[model samples]
Target: MADDDLDPTPVPPRGRRRQARFELEFGDFEPAERGRRRRRGTRGTDDRSVTSSDELTYETADPLPAPRRPRDRDVIVEADDATYDSRLVDRDQRVRGRSRRARRADAPPADDVADEIEALERFEDAIETVRSPSDRGGGSDLGARVLVAIPAAIVAILLVAQGGWIFVVGIAAFGLIGVWELCRMFARTRPSLVASSAGVLAIIVSAALWGREGMTTALVASIPLIFLAVAISVPPGGMPGVAVTLLGVVWIGFALGHAVLLRDSDHGGGIVVNVLVGTFLGDTGAYLGGRLFGSHKLAPRISPNKTVEGLLIGIVTAVVATWFAGLYQDWLSGTDALLLGLAVAIAAPAGDLFESFLKRDAGTKDAGTLFGPHGGVLDRLDAAMFAIVAGFYVWLAMGGVS
Candidate 1:
């Protein structure tokens, strides 16, 4: 069974965070799924129950040989666009472990090809929905709006923050909810309820402790995860095998917490808003540039859509965005805005790629489509979740709001 195939039960993104608590207790990979997929390929060719390999015409012989390392290899193309990573392509290339679905529509009805096709199709559509920029306008217009809206928002928030405490409380609540979404994206799903519940509990406790004492509390508790795996004697593919699961939970939840803290800080500081604006501008520039002029792939193995040209645009945008935001908002000076924006723009993509690696390893898409046309809520916030933390740390280094 694929990571997604482990369970067909649909749950809300909020619910997924609750599930994270359960996930931590169980482990990273699931038991039943790991076993099922492992044995599927290892089964005898003559067995009564033919594996997915039986139906395919691809290589069944010796595995493909590794590529020869080129000593200063010549560029394949005049431009910078590198070829797609075989691994990433393979994930989406051949529909593996799809018991209900076949690789293509040509397959016979016994394979339940129709249902599978529809599911894949819909899921792809949902991904597109999230990827598609809102219908508000095109690049130039959007850029202008961002330029205008961002500074206005920063100024308004800083001014308003001075007037009330309730607003701070509300932003903090948003932070908590965002944290919940982060937990859900990687929650335990296989082996049904048992693993999921364990992950959920682990995160909740982590959060409760962090909420009270701070991140160090969570860090201290995470120290024993590796030794605990040995004590449990669970092999690879079991929950205990996800080497950095404990740390991952902390990274996602705690990192996101900074955004809430910044947004809701007393004395009406605009710490959080400044970081967010910077990240947003950087991402916005990269995205638009990639769409218009991107040719070279940044890291096809991790993500195909990201391009060198786009990345450059993103960096430039981050600086510009920050400068613009800082002009009207006193929270960040020219240098602070530029540096913070650049950091977020660069780091945000890394966070995105990490999540992609996780999802690809699990052989699932979008985590769960809690928000229709948007995949799961976590999918939408993956970059933001990590960016918040990165921004916060950077801010703290510079003597931030706290």
Candidate 2:
């Protein structure tokens, strides 16, 4: 054979290339039978065209096989302002003899859409974990918590103008708010105005009675006297009313009342700083350590965020915080300061988780709305009040606030 005859045909231009061909094996013929065929070649009729044996040539004289119809396309889209055409445009737009499909590529497939929805739900959960309830910026935002903390910081700082009185005022305001929150927390179950008033009265009376009338009188009044009055005013079988009322009297009334007394001292600012710094340091250290090295969950049912690692770090941080407070106050040796630090480290979180338990039982994210950016004033100050009382008791036991 001549070399020119033996050579394969030259490659066609890119645009003039034939459609892709498929190789059929014993079992691979089904898909090709279903696919559209290239219709460029016509049947033997015109002089210029060539015919291939592969195509089905139908004639009147030859017996015909069963007619084969093409399958219809199945596609559906649902949009708010949609304008889809019912007609199919068959032209050069599609490969010869092949159908073209039109739809939004960004729109996920029906099967894949479930995954996207699951991812969106996970994103929302992550946002809630990082942000506080009051930290919303018209929606979910983790920085909302910091925005709330800023105002609280400003209030704490500017109160230097009030000298010793700031502590008393701050404590008293916190006390009343704390009492109101406790009342509201249990108000839904027991909705008697008289009962609510009695609870409120019991709180105020306990604080005054303890702060002035002494611990013995306050304890007596808080137990039998308040409960007796509450039992009479509140209807029978209202444990929520009775228990919460007594709890409010002791937890808010007496503890916060003592916090005011501490703030009114000569170094009240230092005392307030001590309680706040110790409690906040424990909270901060716990959060960071837990995120970094949380191998085991601590009290998962009550507060899942806490961890063993976080608790230990919190204790160390509380000690450091108390040392700083002692330096600022210029009172107490390192040992006494360390003791108070240890006390706050252990007690503050107990108080916090206790409140978290109450909130969980109540099916509430916040105690109330008295505080705008911090849920409720009680929610903001619960730990502070608890730590202050515990620290004060320790200070008195260790020679009474130097």
- Could you say which candidate leads in TM-score? 2
Across residues 34-145, which tens digit of lDDT does each residue of candidate 2 receive? 2222323345754233334454322122233657653333221323111221112322223232322224556656447658765565454346556654565565333455
The TM-score that candidate 2 achieves is: 0.58
The residue-by-residue lDDT of candidate 1 on 1-402, one tens digit each, is: 444443242222236776575444433332222212112233655423223423212111233466986433343342222222122322333335453355456666644655786567556633642453455344444454456555545644664455334543443343444435433544432121222223333444443334425545545554465335423542222332343344344554455445445544432245555555666667777878987898898876556567899988887887677668778876557887777777777777777677666665444666555443334544545676677677766776777645
Clashes of each: 19, 0
TM-score of each: 0.51, 0.58
Cα error, candidate 2, residue 63 (Å): 95
What is the lDDT, from 0 to 100, of the residue 169 in candidate 1? 41
- In model 2, what is the error at residue 82, expressed in angstroms? 58
TM-score of 1: 0.51
lDDT of each: 0.52, 0.60
